[model samples]
Target: MAAVETVRGLVELTRPVNVIAASVLTFIGSFVAGGVTAYPLQTGAAVAATGLAVGAGNAINDYFDREIDRINQPERAIPRGAVSPRGALVFSVVLFAMAVGFAVTLPVVAIAIAGINLLALVAYTEYFKGLPGLGNALVAYLVGSTFLFGAAAVGEVGPAVVLAVLAAIATLTREIVKDVEDLEGDLEEGLNTLPIAVGERRALVIATGLLAVGVAASPIPYLLGYFGAAYLVVVVPADAIMLYGVARSFDDPTAGQVQLKYGMFLAALAFIIGRGALEFGGV
Candidate 1:
């Protein structure tokens, strides 16, 4: 039973849904941007490596923030005694090593990007969590790396690079809103999150502005003749709904599960759009 509990704890630590979402977004971007044809093996390895890295990063975060989790997330595996901190750290290290090893097999660009991501994850866990807007920016940047990784996987960097930029904008908006929703827990743990430092109302305003830009930009690929109408038709409503979620966040952050729900929605929509465009040769 003890061993089983430990396994379960590790599973929870991975946050499988989040891992899948990250991996899928990278997979979609790579497939759409011509990776499967150019470098299928490398692309598959990169995606697997990214998932491991993300999982490890999350575990490391929990390990480092054990004290804070004890307060803000007492029911979390480590804090609840389902997993030992030392054990978690070891697991995290192993995953990180695997991810790095896989990344090293790819192009030099992928290796460099993986190094940067590793560094950022460490910095975020070690010190940035207590910073203000800096923490938010770091999280957004890491999230943006998923789409960029796809581009790098195929040895092409222009189109996927643009998509990555757009992803960053959307991610930053959602991150700020999450800060608001988690404000209470973060404050109790003495985290200097944007919502705690600047207040919810102000954070909402900033998040709203960023989300507006992201939503409007969602149509740009179609307009630029890069993607077909599929992207436009699917993404417009998706972006609008996300924007609605952002607006609703102002009144009640908890009510705005859109931050989480719509991120996956957009990611799925992107995959569909990309596939549709490719199949029909419309774009």
Candidate 2:
């Protein structure tokens, strides 16, 4: 009981799991660029910056989206009274400040990426959320940028670019599915999300097509001699899972989106395994 109630107590607004995952992406980027071991300070700073930035983004998004969540996701921290909008905004600002501080310790390229991401996070809810497909694209880019930021922190940002593109496409799929899931609430709020603008079926179809493209290109890293056999082993199943999730989205959007995220996470793990094995195990 204590473990479930106390130890498991976590802040929903910050989306801690996603924060951690973004940090992993930063580390993976550095690793892929072959500078993670050599540039410890830069790698660590990049990871820290990515995590804090993701947290700040999530909190501020929730702060600005309180009204929408009150209808779409009443159980969310802001809508459920667990966290006030003002408090969330303040917390987001603090996190953003910390992220910037860490980012400033890195190279100029990483700092530039962080600055752009910070501005995007701040503007996403107010300026982009209502636009058809654009909001999803912005969020997708943010998710993928973690890898680029990490790679830039260490040195070259080439290898991670492919990973970023794949991640972005997968994230785009999930975002469209989520928009479809929230169609009713979004409609009530007069928000013109992708599903709202393109219609649910068409939106899901687009998302599926995007995911298919991503899956088809998932082997680019291996073919380019960036990763090894382990990557192929893991990515094959990950691609299958993502394909299924997108297909299922047409029927059960909520479940489909959740599954898509799980698959995406698995795909991310495959990248780490693929690269680590190639570098260390000679696999």
Candidate 3:
């Protein structure tokens, strides 16, 4: 039981849920680029590689944010003394190596992308994370690249670019909202995050504007005929939810943040369903 608890703590240090989500996005990218049957091995490798990279990034983030998290999230592994900072760093390096190993098995494009993303993840945590807007953009780019990485794994990158753009916008909005939610702790830590640099209200406005842009662009895929009517059916509601979340942020940043998270997940689901429906005739 003690050993199991230790293992669980280590896993939690990596933010397993977020890693799983990244893996799912990678698979969705693969599905969007070409059906699963077309690139099963490449898709599987991409999912594994992306998940590991995300997990490593989270672990390193926790290591760097140990002090901030001690105040904002004491229950986290490092803050709770379940994992030491050095141990977490070492674990993260190992995970990054494994991710790169998996990526090297795929096409050269996947290898190149994996290398660049890994560096970006480190740079974000070490330097950019304290800068206003730049940090948010870097994180958003990483999220968006998961789809591109998937497409690259199979040597198909055309349509995935559109999806990547949508993902980046949605992620940027959510990251800003999260900064707003963590403003108090971040300010105390001397982190110049968006909310800290510009007051929370102003940050909320920026986030809302970004969300609006994403909502407006949500229909582009369908209009471009990349996706069918089923995409519109699900994506329309997803966009509406995001818009409502943006409105709610004016009054309640935390609640709006939660809503945006759910909205992004729903939007990704809509993409999968829409694409599947078009390709498999209602999968």
Candidate 4:
């Protein structure tokens, strides 16, 4: 029983859901680039690298955040005494090493993206997370880069660029809202988050404005003839939900951020559907 609990704790630190979700984003990016079947090796490498990287990132983040987790996330693996900080660090390092092994097999551009992502993931929690808007921006860029990484693996990065931008914008908005939600804990940690620097309301306003740009530009893929009308069928509702989430951030940052994630997930689904339409029927 004790061994099982420890195993679960280790797995929890990896946040498997996020790992899988990010991997799917990579796969979607490859699919949009029409590389899924054509460049099977590269696509597989990109997807596998993304999953391992995300898992490593999450574990390392938890390690770095253990102290803060006591205040902000009491039930987290380390905070709950389920995993030691050193153990988490070691786990993350192993995963990062494996991710690198997979990444080196990809195209030059994909390899570069993976290298940058690996460095960024390692540096984010320690060097960047405390720097007011910079932390949020770093997280956003990392999220977006996954799309580009996938496309680069297939040798056609144009279609995935748009998806990357959209994902980044949405991620930025959600990160801000999350900062707002964690104001008290962040303050206690002496972290200079966006909400701490600009004030929660102002940070939320900025997030809203940024997301507006993303929402407005959501139609670019279909407009550029990369996707079809079916894309809008899914994206419109996603945009609406995201808009609502940002608006609601003013009242309930936690709820807003959670709802915003659902919107982002929907948007990713839209990307898959839209690209499928283009690839299968050109509809």
- What TM-score, over all chains together, does every model reach? 0.94, 0.95, 0.97, 0.98
How do all the candidates rank in terms of lDDT, highest first? Answer: 4, 2, 3, 1
Provide the overall lDDT of each model, using Cα atoms, as 2-decimal numbers. 0.78, 0.90, 0.88, 0.92
Winner on TM-score (1 vs 4)? 4
Lowest summed lDDT window (length 10), candidate 1 = 259-268
Please write out the lDDT profile of model 2 over residues 8-75, one tens digit for every residue: 22257789989998899889999999988899999999999898889989989888888888898888
User: What residue runs in model 3 are displaced by over 4 Å at the alpha carbon?
Assistant: none
Best-to-worst order by TM-score is 4, 3, 2, 1
Clashing pairs in 2: none
Q: What does candidate 3's lDDT look like per residue over 1-283, in tens digits?
A: 7667667777997788799889998898888888467889999999999999999999999989999998899999889878888989999999999998899999998889899999998888789999999999999999999999998999898778889999999999989988888888888899999888888889888988888888888888887767778998898888888888877877787898788878888999988988888787843
Candidate 1 on 132-173: residue-level lDDT in tens? 778878887887787778668778656666567677777777
Predicted structure 3: clash tally: 0
Error of 1 at 263 (Å): 4.5
- Which regions of candidate 1 deviate over 4 angstroms? none
Model 1 scores what on Cα lDDT?
A: 0.78
Clashing pairs in 3: none
Give the Cα error of residue 44 in candidate 2, in Å: 0.9
Highest-scoring model, lDDT: 4
**Which one is best on TM-score?**
4
Which regions of candidate 4 are displaced past 4 Å? none
Which of the predicted structures, 1 or 2, would earn the higher lDDT when compared with the native? 2
Q: Please give the distance, in angstroms, between residue 36's alpha carbon in candidate 2 and its true position after superposition.
A: 1.7
**Which stretch of 10 consecutive residues in model 3 shows the poorest summed lDDT?**
1-10
